[model samples]
Target: MPATLPLDLFLGALVTVGLLAYLTYALVRPERF
Candidate 1:
């Protein structure tokens, strides 16, 4: 439905951002991980 489309997009964007941020952090501090 139209109403669920925006929610799906928002969730997808949030997950993508979180993954990118985590990757950046891991790259910055390789010793911890």
Candidate 2:
């Protein structure tokens, strides 16, 4: 099934932000990054 443009964009943005937050947290600790 094909996702609508808006739906795809929203999901993409959501995932991107989630990964970004995770990466930011991981990077914050020098030993963890």
Clashes in each model (backbone N, CA, C under 3 Å)? 0, 0
Residue clash pairs of candidate 1: none
Model 1 lDDT-worst window of ten: 1-10
Task: Write down the TM-score of every candidate.
Answer: 0.81, 0.64
lDDT of each: 0.92, 0.86
* Candidate 1 C-alpha lDDT tens digits along 1-33: 465568788999999999999999999999989
